[model samples]
Target: MSKKVMFLAHEGVGLGHIARTCKIANHLSEKNMCLVVTGSREAAWLLKRSVDFVKLPSLDGLITERARYLGTKLYFDRGDEKAIRFRKTLAEETARHFAPDIIFIDHTFTGKGGEYKDLLLRSGSEIFIVLRPVLGTREESVRHIFGNLGADLIPVLQPKVLVAGDARTSTSSDDVRSFFPTIPIEHVGYLAGPGERTNPSARPYNILCSSGSGFDGEVLSYAMCELAEKQPDISITLIVGPRGSNPPAAPPNVEVILETHSIHQQLERAQLVVCHGGYNSVIEAMSHHLPIVVFLGDGVDPIARDERRIHSRLLSSHYPLLVCEDVKELPQAIHSSRELPAADTYPNALVVNGLANIGNLVATASPAKASDFVVTPIDRTGDG
Candidate 1:
């Protein structure tokens, strides 16, 4: 019988979680049935062509850096009892009807107050996969709180894999084993795979930046304007993803592409990528061997913490990627990064082989037995 995989993603804040989930779903879709359940209509829309998606209406809370609730920083609205109830009902209904063999959950531990957990545990013998980025201390504290909640709400639950995107950056397998001792940890490499390679001769300089609507776009707009002023000769391509975050009025030197599907092609020829530290964009930059300057935004989502941590670690490892906390410093970072050599890019073969291994593991294992599968991290040569 064919395996059924359900991807449960919380679209409360940024597009990173759902975007990563979509990539995994696309990879797994060739052999298994994939269904994506998300709260962000924009995320669903962005991913609709690649995978099957179901949109769950969200509480529509604006995320700010200073917000907090229940000792956790609020990425989305925390106290919408009615929306939570409605989402919970919908999740339960979906799980009950679909009866998936495995469920992949992104960032959200409780699924709006233990709703999906309740359904999965009661259903029995279903594999749960938790996808997360490698986090630092502050974010780990928040994850611990959510993990505690999951343990309390569903005692029997054990995730089959805690897929970390930063596995390539980890010092050792112990780095991952330390956090998820009960379940196996897999370093799935960067979530963004090899996209279409563009002709290198096409553009002298291509700058790709995306903030999925709201405040992120505003910040990116400011950063892009700064870059355009400093480097007037470079050709700038700004892609605004479907959240309708318009780019600021650009100087004649810059060309803004709104909601463009050709980002992969653009990134292929770009000398530099200026982005909001989103998972998909950052990895896409790395996959294409482009130097990146990431601007960390203070959004109301825990996923932003993941972005910041990933960027911080990348900087520490001298990965040739720079993070701009102050948008004013973007141009300088870009200039400095331009001087550095491109970091060692992961081979396409490695990514394909790794993902194929994951699919094979999922296919061969029984739902209840999947949790025991361990993934050995791929060894990449070079310091960066």
Candidate 2:
């Protein structure tokens, strides 16, 4: 018999959580029943109907903004209060009908603002939480470590089984393990998802500029547009979030995709990438052996700024990606990166067999026994 699986993903600030959930769903769809429930406004676009998807509706009190809820973990009336109730309703609806055997949650410790407290009882399914290691102590994660007199907003959602998405090679799984010392976890290698690794080529599109989310994407898009307008000789492509974000118009020389679901395809074809540092973005870019020019948000949105910068510094040390503190510094960085020889180009060091590992995990999963399954990846060579 086929199993029923549901994934609960939150937008938080960037689309990384939603994107990660969607990638896992792809591995499950062919054999098991897969359903994805998300709160992102661009859910339809990002998910791209890759599997059975449920987009939470916008309610009056709970129409949320990333700034109010993402970092502080406090629900401000930026209108998404109904989001909590929405999560409960969606979970209940899925439980009532779909009857999942396993519920895989991405990043979100709690159901919809952690309001879906009784999810285990309601669904009667094993819970799995998958997250990447965000290095450095931020005030929000720090607050969750030490308790406050109910004033502390962000709650660390513990899982019955934690899956840390780090491989032994590129990332230090030990540091990831330290973050959740109490939880039983298994190393599942990289989180590039399915079909994200591609062969590198000397493509015509030389530069690809992207910002992962809708809010901050516009800033990067406009910057790229200005750069493209000035330099007609160099080919450029900008992936601003969705059509709703209204990416700046590009010159005839530049190609702008409102959004491209296939991250690997775009990155492999490009010679270099310019993006804000998000976990999945960094992984995918590196997986395709593309050099990255990391730029933090312009500080327009505090939540976005923090979200973009969260794991950037830690990654710069291990990965070959270059970090640019200022946007104006991007042109010279991109030019300098091109000057490097073939041997100097950063090879795709982070190998991913995430989908195969996940499949092996599901096959060995015991319904009566909930235990950590340390994934032994099938192949370590170049996302093969």
What candidate 1 gets wrong by more than 4 Å, as runs, is 48-50, 61-79, 136-148, 153-155, 166-180, 196-202, 212-214, 242-244, 297-310, 315-318, 345-354, 367-384
Q: Rate the local accuracy (lDDT) of all candidates.
A: 0.60, 0.58
lDDT of 1 by residue, 286-372 (tens): 667677777765552554555465545554354567777766677788778767654654232223233555676668756534343
- Model 2 residue 324 CA deviation (Å) reads 0.8
- Tens digit of lDDT per residue, candidate 2, span 191-276? 65433433345545478777776545666677777777777877787777652265545688677776676666666567777887
Q: Which residue pairs of candidate 2 clash? A: 62-79, 62-80, 62-81, 62-82, 63-79, 63-80, 64-80
How much is 342 displaced in model 1, in angstroms? Answer: 3.0
Query: Would you estimate the TM-scores of all the predictions?
Result: 0.78, 0.75
Compute the lDDT for candidate 1: 0.60
- Give each prediction's root-mean-square deviation over alpha carbons: 9.7, 9.6
Compute the lDDT of residue 319 as modeled in candidate 1: 59
